[model samples]
Target chain A: MNESGHNGLVERVAHELKRSIKIDPSFDESVMAEVRRHGKPAMWVRVIAWWRRPQQLSLSPLSMAASAAVLILAVAVSPVRFGNPDGVEPIAEDPAARVIRFELDAPRASSVTLSGDFNDWDLEATPMTRTSSGEWVTTVKLVPGRYEYTFVVDGDKWVPDPAAPPSLFDDFGGTSSTITVPEV
Target chain B: MVESDGQLVRSVLAGDVDRYAILVERYRDRLGRYAYRMLGNLEDSEEVLQDTFVRAFKSLKNCQDPELFGRWVFKILVNRARTAGSIRGRRDRLFVTDEIAILNASDMKQSEYGWREEIERALSELPADQREAFILKYVEELRYDEMAEVTGVGVSALKMRVNRACRRLRELLEGVYRE
Candidate 1:
């Protein structure tokens, strides 16, 4: 075919290919269902639940951070207000909740957040504070259970915990590090 | 004024989970078409589309520029389509045109149906990368930079692929299309 004919064929094919596709009636509903399944509870509600649970705070120093001392607090002894949004007074702390510390050495990151199934994978639910030594740290009082989580670096990059075991399943292009807290 | 994609993304991120439906609805058909053309079947395309949406939702916080959500999701869809295509493999792809033609036989005139079949056949004949480059450049009408973002290929290489695809497609379709 000549140049004009070739161009015409390309344009014709483009037009044919651009025809609108037929989507199933339930497409939006189906997507929303999946999204809802991953929806998270409010931070305050989770924090409150954490306070009410039995917690035995253990300060086991991880091998990755030899100088990074773990902060252990007796839940029953300390008055804790865990960024409570409702301003509800802290209830009497239960002595059984286990405080697990998560740390990442990201000296350059301006911010880091923890996301996991335990917190319904809510990224904003757990922000990690930066230490003077440049390790990002946050402690969550999780009850005895298996949890899959990744650290959000600089609010946009997801990094799995190097010190923890990787979960068997990687989801949505992010790998999660799994930690199993045994029954206290 | 209509809400920007960024606005919708913000609402969805700020606990308005329902706002996500807008984003899904807005991009579904376009992305579905791309997936269908790339994967050569409705089942595979829809599955890829669904996976792309769910993946985007799960990682929405990682979308640095919410205003470009459409592009971001399209990138995910491209990757998923590539994976699905590779896994399914093109070993049985000779019949893909027949499968699609039969499925839509009732919807078009006989001549139009035959022509469409020829086009799909020609498209499926191109290597996957060339086919992808062709479709994104022509059918989707994306600029070279945008195509680069979606496919992660440099502009010069993509231009080469598109040229080769057009030449190959013309050769494949000439016999049937020429009077």
Candidate 2:
């Protein structure tokens, strides 16, 4: 075909391709159903929910005084823990749970948290510590299983790990990186 | 007066969940067409389209420009279609487009139907990347810059893909047209 004829064919094909298929309103309803199910409370709402959640404390006046006296006596005897001034204690490792280290390089992020199937996708559950070089790192003890996760950068940005394989799209329409722990 | 995409997005984010239906309605058909063309079947396209909207609604707060919601949702649909296509993993499975052509046949003239089927078959034969670039450029009417944003591909590569796609499509369908 000549140049103009070829152009005509291409344009005609493009026009036909652009003719959109008829979509039912039910598609919108199904999407909204999913959105409603995945609807998250705003940060303020979550904060309020946390604040208003019922927490219980039990103490008698006599017991409180006794506890304070004991604390004061212990402090006087040792201004700080003799071997550890910071009073940090080592955590015991579980033989059944495997240690997996998760890291993300987010130098500009004020904070980063790891959320996944392992943590019930809770934003605050697995706060990562910032290293001197600006990488955020955290270790979790997980039993053998496949888990999907993402890094929450600067509190709200959901980012999948660039170094890991991505998981299939979840029911909520998000894709997180997947890690499979082998049975050792 | 019809509300701007920004207004509807803001309302949806502000707890007026019903307003999201409007956004879904506004973009579903356009996005559906892209998905169908990309995936070459109705089932995968509808699934991807639904997921795109749900994902957009779920992540509405992350949308940097609410006024450009359509573009943002189109990006999601593109990503979803890519993933769906990869998972399906074979072109033979895409013969469902033949079923779609038959369903659409009643609405089109006989010659027009045959030409469209030839085009769709030719489109489905191109490499996924070329088909995607061509569809975004011509069918979706997206500019190269916008296509770059959606596909995360550089403009030069996209232009090459579009050029190759047009050439290959013409080569595939020229015989049918001449006859």
Candidate 3:
């Protein structure tokens, strides 16, 4: 009787909650219809967006403090982060004289590839082999300069670093991280 | 009826606006629920969800990960809800979009305001972090990892907030939800 009572309790709670709100089945269609009202996105949109960012950008100490606070909020409030032992190995301290590492917490991806301006945006510059725990890791030698980079997972999807340095605002209006590789 | 999120993103990037429909369809329910939970108003949730997609589409190129579509949209929705809530607060009436009457109905049932008011007041009493954690974990049904992606916080803190929120909620809803 106790077991039956517990089951009944769960059912009643579920029923009451389900009765509270209603959502349309075709919500996606409506939203898509709304989006199409503006037309298709431009090909090379990211590249174009990148070129249009405030070209005269500069970083200052004050900006760093503000960005750090915002960063802390973004970090603490967000449910995802970089460097999980059970997630990504967080690149074992770079050994090369001028080393840069790219990591993504993609446990399901078979093979990850590194691509960005550092490789002249070459898709084949460095193909990241997966590790036992499933994160993809890759490193590239670099000269002291800033670079834009993204991870190509299993030959599909572009993922940015959720834990990198400040990214400039795209003219299209979202942020991506930037890496200012320092001189060794 | 569908393509992988990556395909849709590629199509969007390649100028196929229609592909966006799939993503909208894919995430519409989740996004709506998230908005509704956060704002507690269907109308405001709809508005926020609509605006989020609009902004996302306008800036699709910035969506670095199509597979992480849910997370990306979630981040956008979080920002929009915060903005909407703040703006509504200035009016001192919450600018409720079609939910106050229904949820707030219970007040008449009791000599006091009602169950709806109690729920809202109790939720409002929570610190933002704890409330967000509870809503996402319990109401949104997000796995801890997915919640992490959306909030960018450590799992331990999230666990603490959810636990505290649950304890507080049980205390607040003693007689109402208990029955």
Candidate 4:
């Protein structure tokens, strides 16, 4: 009995039979078109324009370090909210920030505040605006160092800041993006 | 042939601006076939091929060898396929053509053979890695070393995969073996 209990020779012969390929007449043209799509655009200006764009999303800071921190918080932890829209957004720039952004999908609690080392554990440095999506954002900028923060979901709940850098030590705590503020 | 891709990449990176056509023309067919076989979906295959070329073009500077453009491009396609494949719950099936090809493969009646469909069904039954090794080595006709480079697997592991594929295929084609 062969491996499958079939005539091993016939199976071997059949295995010898390769899939006959009929390269579609259009195959070359279509793949060429794809090639063209991937190739830089014919227009120098356009190709240059496309080249200027970052290949992968700059996960940390998207350019405007200040705007990034605010947008960073907005884009991150997009699921919750700080109590009200009543404070200036702190601009934290330096060492291109690396952070995981999430949108708050729910409403703010009566005692929503951001707490982190940047604020010396102050839950009142800045208030967050509640967007229609129920997102609250705060830009907490720290020097080139690792810091931990969380959202005071409500007065009693001490939750990690959703927009903050992810912390892998959630076993003892939660997730936070490790921001590498470059030393200029 | 590989030199052309390298030249195009250099030109594209240096802002020479138009040498990419040669690279595209040179690689489109081969990479398309590889991508099609890897993913089975025509649109996705095409997308992966396009993306592979785009990424390969963009990251051309980082490529260690301008000479091994084929291998480099294949790696891009493989990575793209693997990433996309991982996301899908079902494995992508492989067919030689981007869309179904009606033309016949090279005549091989020199050996008594089972129906093409049976071979395909059997070929599909092997695990993904084994099937990959089998197709690349036997169908695509890549050498064991080349398969290792393309797959990023060690040669021994690739051989194991090929052996497993042959064994599984034999089991799948019992009737042929019986005959």
Among these predictions, the greatest DockQ belongs to 1
Order of quality (DockQ): 1, 2, 3, 4
Provide fnat values for all models in the order shown.
0.38, 0.36, 0.23, 0.04
Instruction: Residues A46-158, candidate 3: write the lDDT tens digits.
Output: 44444443346578999989998999999888766676456454534334348777777788887677755454334455888777878778888877777766665555455
Question: What is the C-alpha lDDT profile of model 1 across B106-161, one tens digit per residue?
Answer: 98799888888888889988888899999999999999988876765557878999
Clashes by residue pair, model 2: none
| lDDT tens per residue, model 4, B1-179 | 34565555655655554566577667677666665555554666666676776666655554656667777777667656654544331433443332342223344342332355455556545665676677787657789877765654557878888887777777776665444
Model 3 residue B71 CA deviation in Å:
2.9
Best by TM-score: 2
TM-score-best of 1 and 3: 1
What DockQ results do all the predictions give, each relative to the true complex?
A: 0.24, 0.21, 0.13, 0.08
After superposing candidate 3, which stretches have Cα over 4 Å from the reference? A1-34, A46-184, B93-121
- Name the 10 consecutive residues with the lowest summed lDDT in model 3 chain B: B89-98
User: Could you give the interface RMSD of each candidate, to one decimal?
Assistant: 8.5, 8.2, 10.1, 13.4
Model 1 regions lying over 4 Å from their true place: A41-184, B98-104
Better of 3 and 4 by TM-score: 3
Q: What is the lDDT of residue A16 in candidate 2?
A: 82
For candidate 2 chain A, which ten residues in a row score worst on lDDT? A45-54
